[model samples]
Target chain A: MSREHQKYRAPDALDHTRELLGKLAREVSVSDWHLVIEVRPDDLPEVALRLRDDETLSCKYISCIIGVDYVDWMEALYLLRSQEHAIPVRLRVRLDRERPEIPSVTYIWSGANWHEREAYDFFGIRFIGHPDLRRILTREDYDTHPMKKDAWPHRVRRTEWRWEDIERPKRLPGETDRRDRS
Target chain B: MSTVESKNDAVNPGSPVNQDGPAKPSFHLEEMILNMGPQHPSTHGVLRLVLHLDGELVVSVEPVLGYLHRGFEKLAESRTYLQYMAMISRLDYLSGFFMEWGYVRSIEALMGVRAPKRAEYIRVIIGELNRIMSHHVAIGDFMLNLGAVTPFFWVFRDREDAMDLVEMVTGQRMMYNYLRVGGVRWDLPDEFEAGCRKFIKEFPAKIDEYEELISDNEIFISRTLGMGIIKPYEALDYGISGPNARASGIDWDLRREVGYSVYPEFDFDVPLGQHGDCFDRYKCRIEEMRQSVRIIEQALDSICGGPVNIKLPPMIRPPAGEAYRAVETPRGEFGVYIVSNGGLRPWRLKLRDPTFSAISMIPKLTAGNKIADLVAIVGSLDLLMGGVDR
Candidate 1:
């Protein structure tokens, strides 16, 4: 009966002719329960800045920064909420799969530093201006970005425990892998 | 998995997590590095904090995580919708029901069906009890960090009674994988109402006892008051949620804000603190326990008779869409973001643990504080390594 009640509007997100967001929004759409404002990778910083400072759409609180790998392309979703309105906004930025890079919004929200590092650790996406862009969750020496779909080459949903399914580390140079015959 | 690093040389390789601070403490000439936990009890989980200290004062604290990472998110991509339900609770074991509730809420939202009225009320009832149970541990463990062993025992002793009530209904005390997509596993047993009512009735008195026992103590006041003050703006900037954020005067609670489940039907108050400090955090939690008791009593009074679960096909696949559903867990806003590609299994499932955001701010919060106060501050945050490491 009502479109206002149906689709979640993020301040002036849907309308692209207004001001700051209007000049930047590449593709404005709605997803699930959020006003999904798709912006260019380079424009992520500006878009985030306005989203935080704009009185109407003051999206100051960022809940999560999710990075998704679609095999062909990469997407970074920022879940934002405003305390004044409690309206949730999703800033979706598409990245090149070959060299997935996005301007970090860490400057806007300090909390995004750790989240950006986590995305960098998992998806191998680089945040251009991230001061501490090191891996947050995985060991720095670990080569594989485990969250990527291709990370697990031979991922078998093992129904029963198999001795071969378990990966064992090789013994140290001098330490022998002695096992009793029993 | 809790890797409590020793006094020095705790950094894994090349000192990855621990970077040198910008404003280095020049007074000491060299920052004395100290490692608190990957194994310390106060750490709560496998969390290693590499603290750079000048004498007894912490210059900068770097938290090293992933010691307890089990790759639960990757596991969800392979398992079907039903199969993944079993492990969601493991995301935050203290309030496993909330974890399960968050995941199932997204699935149910995607399918466009709410659980029957009775089922919702039952969830509210169980969820509040679980909140009290979790806060018990948070309070007890916080007291333990302050070196008060008696309050820890007191909270634990009462926690067992609350756990017994949950066990009677869910068949498990801690890891209650009892929440299904459309509704709960089963309706409340006949005796549960009487027992739960008794717990809620006595629960308020128990909360009062706890407040009287620990709240006014001089040691606790001195240790917590004006220590680790999280400015409201800073709290919002860091994405802190639940009691921690409320203690900082944010006033954002998903149960009240999102109105998920039957929370809107309840009559309760979300206690907020004026000063966002360690003491306020503890007080907010204690007040929340009382509010939980209020919700439980209301739910018990209004719970109606109906089927707890809805009928669904053996093999179910949600349409290709994305949904995010968060619940006001004891810890914070525990949200489950699910992306279904019209498959039996989800394409991607992100279990957002509130502890991740809380832990990210640890280095900022504990800096300049003495090592003893660092324990007090960290304890007040009520961080669980199981959730953060995930």
Candidate 2:
């Protein structure tokens, strides 16, 4: 990095956030230079409110909410940014594979309402208190949350798309094991 | 219930409208439910707005989406990194360059690579040109929504010039998938710089003409000045970004704040609005077009000769990691988030479209406005469903 080309930012931006975050975050680390905080599903709302209302880490802009299904576990990622700091702060919440749910942060940031609904629509991760937690993109009656790993065709598996080896493709939770997917 | 009563049924139970029955024909005692386009002319795409109306005033608006949902996020899980680049531009066809740029930036970051200096400059040139083209549609469509037809035709006349320059370099007018992972597909064509210089030199005069046509016109000002006001806090609270957030006097622009790519090297200014109304949003786009012109001039002057792309194998696998990289498109900050599991395809790829945030805030912003103003407000916000549905 060149000296004159780079703009000024806090040297230990992550530490400042760590101190402010206090005990709310179960784990704090860096990913791609962005501060990532792992919090329990229940602590999500409190952690989000602190991030928004805090002075140094005023992460007001809600960039995106991402949901991932890893077969064994599901992940929800909230990417936020502070206009002042120019540093992105990510909140990672892991949930049970059978019932992936977390407290909603829509009250903290109104923009999260749609993002949370989108997460619910795509990954079947329930945002516990979202006012209108319905499908945002897909049709409301769409049977499956298509982003889940097991939402793949009954012939194709998640990690390995070896259609020949498996007699039955993995089915989503609460779904019948019938191989009707043609 | 009879035909008259069914037509005037209560849309919201507590909105000073009687739910028991339609009481009077003098002024309808029940709220009327108005369903606007999955086909209306003003709505830019197949966006459906279910507006709860009491006479001409809107009680509440429930925007029904997914009419054009093509499953962009779900489709990414099956495509390889290189295969996905071709589809990113389709997210927002108006600002396709920025979409490709955002996608390539994240992949390059995941692989710890940077495009050559020449490639970066070329990217900036094409990107700003794309920005001008997008703002053209915004201003044209905004005027069209306001019942003005001349500006729409005028912007289309000028947009063709910018498209020609883009076509020369990228070979496609709309879906120019020119940006590659490491750098770009190729170096700038010999005629691109000269043609770009000619366009920038004359572009300012064309902006002045658009200003002359609509800036001080009585009808335009009366309709837009204080309509659809988004407070500064509301802009932040709703996650609005790009010109819509900047128009609200939020004082944030990713190009200046984050200063990614080669934006910092050039000297330019970001315009801010005072009232955060429809006028400010329109004014912000006009001023942004000027600023984009300035960026093109500076980039053209400073561009240096170098190898355009660094050759890597056709099939590339970035190390398992997650990265979020956003670029300031004309609408707002268009971001691409990628999570790889050391595999051929992304485990999760989320396209954070700025228009989605803009659309979500519509129900809050449009309440209590006249149906006419609702048209003005939606048009002024410059809604594009391509990216939002994705």
Interface RMSD of each: 3.1, 2.4
> For model 1, how does the per-residue alpha-carbon lDDT over B1-390 read when each residue is reduced to its tens digit?
333332232433335334553332223245788888899999998899999988898999999999999888888987899888888788889988898889999998788777898998988988988999899999999999999999999999999998999999999988898988788898888899889878877878888899899998999999999999899999889989999999998887887777777777888899999899999999999999999988888888888887999998867799988888788899899888888889999988887889999998998899999999999999999998777777
Residue-pair clashes per prediction, in order, are 6, 0
What are the clashing pairs of model 1? Answer: B2-B38, B2-B46, B3-B38, B4-B37, B4-B38, B4-B39
Give the lDDT of residue B84 in candidate 2: 86
* Candidate 2 displacement at residue A29 in angstroms: 1.8
User: Residue-wise lDDT of candidate 2 within B275-356, one digit each (tens)?
Assistant: 8999999999999999999999999999999898988889989899888888899999988888889898998898999999
**C-alpha lDDT of residue A55 in model 1:** 81
lDDT of 1 at B366: 90
Q: Which window of ten consecutive residues has the lowest lDDT sum in model 2 chain B?
A: B6-15
Q: What DockQ would candidate 2 receive versus the native complex?
A: 0.44
